[model samples]
Target: MAAERRHAQMNSYSDIELFSLATQFQPANYIELLSTSSVSTLVGCGQLCNQNVKCRTFDYDSYSFMCRLFEGAVETGSLVPSGSSTSLVGAVRFQPNLFAAFGQDCVQCTNSRYLICSSSNNNTCQCPENTIWNGVKCKNQGYEDANCSNNQWCRQDVEYRCNNMTIIKTDLPGNDLMWNTTANFSMCCSWCGNHSDCKAFTWISSPGMSFGMCYLKWSRGGGGTINPGYISAYY
Candidate 1:
């Protein structure tokens, strides 16, 4: 079922076909291009390009798997043989109002009920507060009290307590920055509180693990199930 869902998600992106051999195009503009880690396939590389608002064209290395995304157009006259397996893959441009296809408008997104759109984020639609984007849709965030084992916090409804763990129904949207591996419960809470967008946080500690992993979230939606090693809390 998971594999099926992933395949379906992959199919949702615009198609990109890669060239057979290593090729190079004239360096268009250094200021408009950014390079990042290469994905295993051209499709994966294209998805990355499509997600970024600035990316217009891309070059992928078949051997090293390095992906270079460009914001401007590719010059055909610059195409030459590099003698390596690096190839110029096709590009896929997403809609300006990325959420329009998802049944939302950019103007409506600017209201306090939703997060504002920005060019830096490629104009992607963000889920509203207390809701999570579950790949295809947004859903509500649920909560529950912790079991109170292994130094986990027990919730006290009346009095505010520090370092207490409350289970959130979904994993927050967006990629979580690894705050620190050696941070304690209090430090993790402080880190989340300091960040304006951090709505919730989770800490994972295992017996054999050297350090716990802290995940600060922006959106409060679709973590499917609770793991025994995880302790989640909201601000």
Candidate 2:
């Protein structure tokens, strides 16, 4: 029975020492968390590393035995004990090291945008539909740049050649990017074209980057380089 039984995670806090239970079946992203429960439950934020398969490390309340599913796995010093007052229990909270967990132990991901190295094969990224794979990451619309910054924008025809492709917005700070939506690169370009202060743009597919949404930015402050294919038109 021990050999076949799957492991599940649970947490314990006593006299300032914490103990984590082992688990098998991992979660994609802490999908269904009932944070308001009487007990506190937490999961790691990244996938399991060095293990045979995906699993999560979790911590539950003193008397409970439920594994909290993080986006992935737990790191050595990642988990933290919730404060006595705050309810780490029923309220859902994301792990702080979520992204780092995905990039753990990676030696060659310094310049790669979304390429995560795993023990069992490398990670797969969700790229743009019109784009193709380029060994490391995804490129849009037949682009072939080493860092995904080459000819990112192309001639959408003469009168309206895409201007300043592959731009980033800083007007609203962090409000420019969205994840997990059904918008396409063309639509994203159009949106940038219509905005008054939009000086440049960068667009990536959803799911892998930021869910399924596009990130739009307005840069009143200049001094940034532009991609080669754009027509130098201002929005």
- For each candidate, the alpha-carbon lDDT, in order, equals 0.49, 0.32
Candidate 1's TM-score: 0.34
Between which residue pairs do clashes occur in model 1?
Answer: 132-221, 170-223, 171-223
RMSD to native for every prediction?
Answer: 19.2, 16.4
Best by TM-score: 1
How displaced is residue 203 in candidate 1, in Å? 58
lDDT of 1 by residue, 129-149 (tens): 333444554332222221233
The alpha-carbon lDDT assigned to residue 214 of candidate 1 equals: 71
Off by over 4 Å in 1: 1-10, 75-78, 93-235
Against the true structure, candidate 2 has what lDDT? 0.32
Error of 1 at 225 (Å): 72
Model 2 ranges with Cα > 4 A deviation: 1-161, 164-182, 207-211, 220-235
lDDT (tens digit, per residue) of candidate 2 on 123-177: 4323223323444433223121111333443212213235445333222223343
